[model samples]
Target chain A: MSYKAITLKKRPETVISEDLFDVVELNQPDLLDGQVLVKLSHLSLDPAMRGWMSPDENSYIPPVKLGDVMRASGVGDIVESKNEQFPVGTRVMGLMGLTEYAVSDGSNLNIVPKEIPQEAILSVVALPGVTAYHGLFEVLKPQKGQTIAITAAAGSVGSLVGQMAKNLGLTVIGVAGTNEKCQWLTEELGFDHALNYKADDFQNQLTNASSNGIDLFFENTGGTAQAPIFNAMNAHGRIAVCGLIAEYNKTEASAGPSWVGIIKKRLNIQGFTMPDHFHKFPEYGKALGQMLMKGELKYRAHTLEGINSATSGINLLFSGENKGKLIVKL
Target chain B: MSYKAITLKKRPETVISEDLFDVVELNQPDLLDGQVLVKLSHLSLDPAMRGWMSPDENSYIPPVKLGDVMRASGVGDIVESKNEQFPVGTRVMGLMGLTEYAVSDGSNLNIVPKEIPQEAILSVVALPGVTAYHGLFEVLKPQKGQTIAITAAAGSVGSLVGQMAKNLGLTVIGVAGTNEKCQWLTEELGFDHALNYKADDFQNQLTNASSNGIDLFFENTGGTAQAPIFNAMNAHGRIAVCGLIAEYNKTEASAGPSWVGIIKKRLNIQGFTMPDHFHKFPEYGKALGQMLMKGELKYRAHTLEGINSATSGINLLFSGENKGKLIVKL
Candidate 1:
């Protein structure tokens, strides 16, 4: 049997175009010892994948090599298993590539309940949910009644962070590019306040929205959002910086406000890669799954059908075109 | 009985001139129920005093008011005592005024060895030594073979930090203003390397000196020194910012290097005031006193003979004229 996979043909200029990924077919690998074959169901598109596409080294993970199978996290069903840990008919999510079928050593694989809705399993309780859970509760550690400011509030991690902060009894403030996204955050997501970042009086609006200082900041988009968010930060504020999707493909450094604010305010700014926090993932996943079952959390997804349209789903993340988790159905 | 005391007549503009301090004669107060009358001996002339002179909102202690006795730390003999905790003839050090005599509640006072040289007791194993100890092992936490970089290397805290790091089996690099200070750090203090910040190739020297990257940075002077120090920082490096003496006297905000290096490199920058760590002083002071008594540590002092000379002693600090601890003897 053969499968289609996107190969990194070349680095894209600004917006990732179709030329960046190519569909390739190859023979399915035989399951070796301690390995299993997974029939991919859904491919997770993340802002971090943009970092992999780049040649520069930023954090823990290395840049994705040219002509290698484009890296992704996907939910799949075990077609066959030579490993006793993961038997046939089991469902798993791990470092499965952007392909129709792939083989894993069961190294980072986990099998969850098949009774759960596939979208809920893949969306609200997947990477986005886990990222928001650990990044907010574990890293940021917001106190009740403290203000939490989040960037890209309509997007996967940001939306979840705002909701989680609210659930933890925090006053949530969100910044989004459009008026509709702002409405969706405050009205639908139960955020205390939301500001349109593209407004002429954006900074003023942010100041008005958060009269109380921001105690915890979940930074997703870095460039323009960082300045106002930092200004509103209280003394000894904690910032859990996850992604800088705003400056991903840009040639030059994103210029805005002075970072002396960090020193003057004495902020704790930390950058984290989620896999580094894998030790806590099980706990986070279990907790997040319970929250979903209790209807205390919400997640949205922008799904693109087939491996052929995966590039478009990834590109939509950069443009803020996708409302939530950008996924490709295999 | 009357005593002469230096009062904060006005805020200083340059070098903390004579007019900045007004000497006035006042009748000595009777010791209260819990109070002790102290005869001032050696007054510590710290760079932090400059902070106390101005009405800055960001100070740990309130600014010395106009017509009020200037705040200081000194070793004094308890000539009269009503407090059971501190008996008469005790040699004590605590927060006092720059005066011939002071009355205290014995709340902050700590007795010192009468046999120890007055200069040695006032210079080392006091606030400066404790600052170095707690800032290094407690905050920065340098490990063996790792590189530790310090600014103001010839000063009290910086010198002790380098010596302690050396004793802990770490490679220590010192940054000082002059060749003499650098020589003292490398040749006498046993620092592995010393770079003169005034030299044209200072940044290159610092970078070359810490090729393995700086695991810890003891930041006493924050402005110009931060650029080179940060350039040499390792990933996840820790910086203990004890003071920002470089920018302390400036009337306007000084332009300095961006701290975005902190976010990119995942560095931990913490600004600490000595009082916040005063709880560890007893433990730190005992250990540091042992180090000094064993001849494991060395220090120097630039002493002013009279209370009238406090202004000149303070001026010497900004001029970088003092080789070590700047003190005024009463």
Candidate 2:
């Protein structure tokens, strides 16, 4: 049997392009002992995928090698299984790659609940949701009456962070690229205030929005946008370095904010990856699921049809074109 | 009684100069009902003084006002006491200023023990020692067999950090500006390896010295030297931001290490001020004193005589000229 797969052909120097990958059909091997063959239904496109494409040894995970099936997280159904634990037709989510079929020995695989919607599973209960959970509660440790400022406010993780901050009785200020995204943040996501970073009065807007000074800065885009936020940070503020999507595509080093701010403010800046804290995923999923069931948590998934659109769908993340979680539906 | 005092005449733009201060002779005031007259003996000069001179509202403590006696910590003897708690001839230390005489309400003062030498009381058992202890044990939390890298390794805080890290069974790598300071770090301070950041092969030396990767970075000097160290940091490394002595004299913002390194390495960087952690000073002083009594912890005090040398003594910290704790003996 043959199935389609997207393979990394060449690493890009800057922003990802469609030419970097090649979609080809490959034969599926027969399932061996304790192995299961999964037919992928959805592929999650994340900003971190850019880091994995870089040939440099700077990422937490190893770089995707040339001519290999591109690494990705996806939800799928087991079409054939030799493992008793993962029986045939068992739906699961894992690092299953951007391919039509994946063979796993049950390592790094999770059984998806039938209750959660298929699209919501990847956006609200998968990597982005869990990442937002760990970063906000575990790392930032929000306190009541504190102010939280988040970048990429319209994106999956940032949107979730703003909602979570609000639920905990903290003020939420969000920064996004477009005016529409800003409106969505404040109106749809219930953010206290949202600023368009591309606006001419962005600096003034940020200062006014964070009048009490930001207590917790959930940094998603780390570039020029963070400079003003750093200056407005209160003493002993905490910065959760979730993602640097702004600088992810840049080939050369850009001037960062004066670190003097960190010292003078006595700030605590910590960076984290979700996989490292996977042990808490079950607890996080349950909590997130409860919120979703209560209609307290909201998420959006920008789904691209077919595996062929995987390359272009990922570009939406860097371009800020994706309204929410970018995903490729197979 | 007439006594000399160093007053902040003007704030400097960058590097401290003698013109910024005025050595004025003023008549000492009569002690009030609750006040004590102190004959200041030893004035503690620290890198933090540079921050205090900045007219900006960035420091934890407000900037020193022009014409006010320059803020400093010092050891003194009570010459006259209207307050019975601080009787005559009682040796004490506090923010006694850069003056030959001062009047205190006995609120902030601490009675010094006769067991420790006068200079050691200020250098080892006081601010610098307590700062190092809190930064190392409380902030960085070094583990056995880990590699600890410290900048400004020959300075008071850095030197103490290296010694403590060694005692904790961690490999120590020190970074300094001059070859002599680097030599002293390895030879006398027992740092496993010392790298001269000024050497032509500095980057190579840093990479080789931290071959296992730096687990803990005690940052004293923050500038170009830290860029390479950031690249050499291990996953989940902790950076205790102590001082930015290297950037103390720079008027313009210089490029910092790509913050991308922090996210990729998942590093935890926290800046701290000693005054904020004064509650732990007694615990720290006891541990440091025990180490000193065992001859396991050694410290040096480079004392400048008279209040007139206050301006130049402070410049020593920025120029990296002082070999140890920069202090002024009045």
Candidate 3:
């Protein structure tokens, strides 16, 4: 049977339009040796999807070329398996492109258990959840009672980072774009304080919230949200330069105060891509999954219907229209 | 007997004028129970002294206030001693200040061997040598065959840094102000290459010199010297933030490329005062002292005639007039 998949129509402009993607029919491939065919159940739409759109020199992975199947990770079931490693009816999620059917070599794919809800496993316990876990615990290694200021804190990674930092005994402060996101962070997510970065006096509020100093700065968005937060960093602060969602679409280099402050404060700023720490995924999955099952973790999964809606779901991420992990149910 | 000591008459502006220092008379104090009266000999005048002149908040030590005895480290004779730890006629160097006669509690002081020439011990094997040793091996830990770049490469610390990196099997590159200093770095110092930063095509020369990529950046001077060097850094480069001599006396913040490149390159920038690593001094001193005695290391000491001439000597550092360690003989 023929299956439907999204293809990149052309390179995007300042804003991603529906014209960038084309939904098309494709042949269902026969499973080769050591391969499994998966029928896509849910597709993960993340901010990093923007980086995969066009070729760039500085990113972790090569960008998606035009007319190719758009790259994505999705949770799905095994319809056929040529290898005993993954039997028929086994559920899996890995580098499955944006399609109704996908075949994997089982190189890096893992089977999802029947006990875990496929949607829940695809949502809070997905790559976004583990990215937060490893980035905060492994990269930042913030100590107890230290103040942690995280940007995009009400979003998927930021929300998890705030909760984890609080669990680790840190004074967690969240910087969200809206009052609703901030309220969720402070009331529901256990963040000690939340500041709206869109507010005029965001810096002032941050200074009051992080009175001691920002020991750990988990940067997600990189423009105006980052500028003031950088100023509030303490001496010898550790900044995990996780993502630059703020500068992803912008053409020009964003201007800000001199980082002589970085030298003066003796800060450690590190740029990280999640794949660099994939070795810790098993450990992260075990711990973070336990926390979720115990009711200690609260996460929201924003799902859009149909694989064709993947483009719009991804764009909503940059526009801040979605509150959490923006996924597509195929 | 009255002895002369250097005193700062006024804070310096342009080149330090003759009137900036005054020779003052003093009655040598009787040694207290744990004190010693030292007859000061070789006084060290460092670029860090220029840091002491400005009223900046961030400092290794507070700036020597106007009309105060200028702060310095020196070798001296213990003419009278009541302390059991240090006997009479012992040669010592510590915070003896810029003076002919000074009283020390022996808290910060260290007794030097009478056999080592006072000038040799005070010059090559002194604070500058220790600063380079600890900052490089302890902080940067550059591996063998790696390219290491140092700013102010002809000065006391930078000169030693190039030599030490060489000894550690690194390909050393020096960035200096003049052709002569550049020649000195490449010729006498055994550095692989030296780039005269004053050249119009200095950035090109730096790229050509460090063909492999800079693994360790020993930053002494800031501003124009540092702007382009950022591009030459390799991934996971370590920068020992030794000093910013270029901006030490400037009243305003000068513009340069921010360390955003550092983040992209995954650089580790650490600013430190020597006192912070005082625990490791004994280990450094022993290794460096052995290197000096073997004639494997070389240093230049720019000697000033009298203690009263300290102001002129200090300003000479900013003007880049001094060839090496600027010191005063009292």
Measured by DockQ, the strongest candidate is 2
Q: What is the C-alpha lDDT profile of model 3 across A1-330, one tens digit per residue? A: 899999988886666788899999999877778988888899988877777785755455788888999988889999999989889999887778899998888876777776777667766677888888877987798899899999888888888898888988999999988999999888888899999988999878988998887899998887777767887877778888677677767765464344456556666676666766778777878887898888777888888999878877788888888877778887
DockQ of each: 0.28, 0.70, 0.38
Backbone N/Cα/C clashes per model: 0, 0, 0
- TM for candidate 3 is 0.92
- Across residues B35-137, which tens digit of lDDT does each residue of candidate 2 receive? 9999988999988888888876667989989999999999999999999999999999888788899999998798877688878888888888898999999
Compute the lDDT of residue B38 as modeled in candidate 3. 88
- lDDT for each residue of candidate 1 in A83-185, tens digit (9 for 90 to 100): 9888899998877778888888998687877876666777777778888888888778888989998988888888889988898899999988888888988
- Regions of model 1 farther than 4 Å from truth: A12-18, A252-266, B12-19, B56-58, B251-264
Which ranking of candidates, highest TM-score first?
2, 3, 1
Which pairs, if any, clash in model 2? none
User: Each model's C-alpha lDDT?
Assistant: 0.81, 0.88, 0.80
TM-score of each: 0.92, 0.96, 0.92
Candidate 2 docking quality: incorrect, acceptable, medium or high: medium
C-alpha RMSD of each candidate structure in angstroms:
2.8, 1.8, 2.7
Q: Model 2: how far is A320 from its true place, Å?
A: 1.4
